[model samples]
Target: MSAAPHTPAPKNLGRTALICAGVAMGMTGLSFAAVPLYDMFCKATGFGGTPMTGTAGAGKVLDRTMAVRFDANVAPGLGWTFTPESPDISLRVGETKTVFYKITNKSSRASTGIASYNIAPEKGAAYFVKIQCFCFTEHTLQPGESLEAPVVFYIDPEIAGNRELDGMKAITLSYTYFASKAGQPLAQGGTAPAKGDAATSNL
Candidate 1:
């Protein structure tokens, strides 16, 4: 006949199948890891207008001061009152400081919220590094309960060197709280929050 039609070895077919299976498994794993990887990438590079993250600065606070305006809001469904304790602050670039926002649950039922944050003049996001932020976590409030959420951060000194940001003396850091079902439980055995002095600033 024609050399038995030059049949391929079964072992070769099995090896090819195994290689395809391995590649599929690897792709699945990558898919599972994609979200966390993207989050880390954003926090590191401030890509897509995401803010950068860092620990305490290098202790090289610049002499030049910059205005940091604070703004807070509650998404419609949250049923929470939110406001920045301070309207604005002035600090030297690279100076680390804390700012607090007050959040109060207006609903008669327990509620949970997660805060989303952004810095205006989006170009400054890359240089507004947050060392610690309440936005990184969730908050739960009892009916009529309030809390002072704090954020510790510093403007990267390199921001002062960016020509594009020249004359950008003020940067607004804004936060909005959204209703959530998944958050820490509301604390029990505490007094209900009232409308008075919603936020207190310890900074």
Candidate 2:
């Protein structure tokens, strides 16, 4: 009457361990691939665009124009042209400015894509830069269609206070563009700082 001889439950320790190991390996693979995947996504969507970080110290003044570059691909049957109207722009500490970029599609086919961007000068990374950016979105342009894109940005006031940034007069913000197979829109080139530029009042 001892419950017909008590029997211990069998433990599938090996199976459990294998399942855990598999999950761990899968996660590791995903982690390892995340950067490349993210790069692909960014290249495809221009999501968040890419930022050009500068080595200039905080609160440092920058008086240089960084070249902005754009990259795009048009379909075989499509012809497209894209350029930044104001590729090279100058900005002083705490001053806000806006630049315009133009894109045109001369082909008979319609083109669509997003335009993302980043700034350069390696020392002016802390400046407050904003793009009326078109990245991470889809834009369609018909034959012979042209559009103007604008980017608004400013240098952080802190730049003037940085000891390393002292005597820095300017910083150039650049953007590179990319187009989708259907003719995605991309930036043209990088921006370079103008020579002998002077710093302005903080904003």
The CA lDDT of each predicted structure is 0.74, 0.50
Tens digits of per-residue lDDT, candidate 2, 63-168, equal: 6433333333232333567666643555455455566667788767886645444433445554444434554456678888888876555556655566886755
Model 2 Cα displacement at 142 (Å)?
A: 1.0
Per-residue lDDT of 98-192 in model 1, one digit per residue for the tens? 98888899999997787766666667778889988897378879998999978898889887778978788887887766665454222122322
| After superposition, candidate 2 runs with Cα above 4 Å error | 1-15, 18-78, 181-203
Best by lDDT: 1
Report lDDT (Cα) of residue 6, candidate 2. Answer: 68
Best by TM-score: 1
Tell me the lDDT of candidate 1.
Answer: 0.74
* Residue 200 C-alpha lDDT in model 2: 21
TM-score of every candidate relative to the true structure: 0.79, 0.54
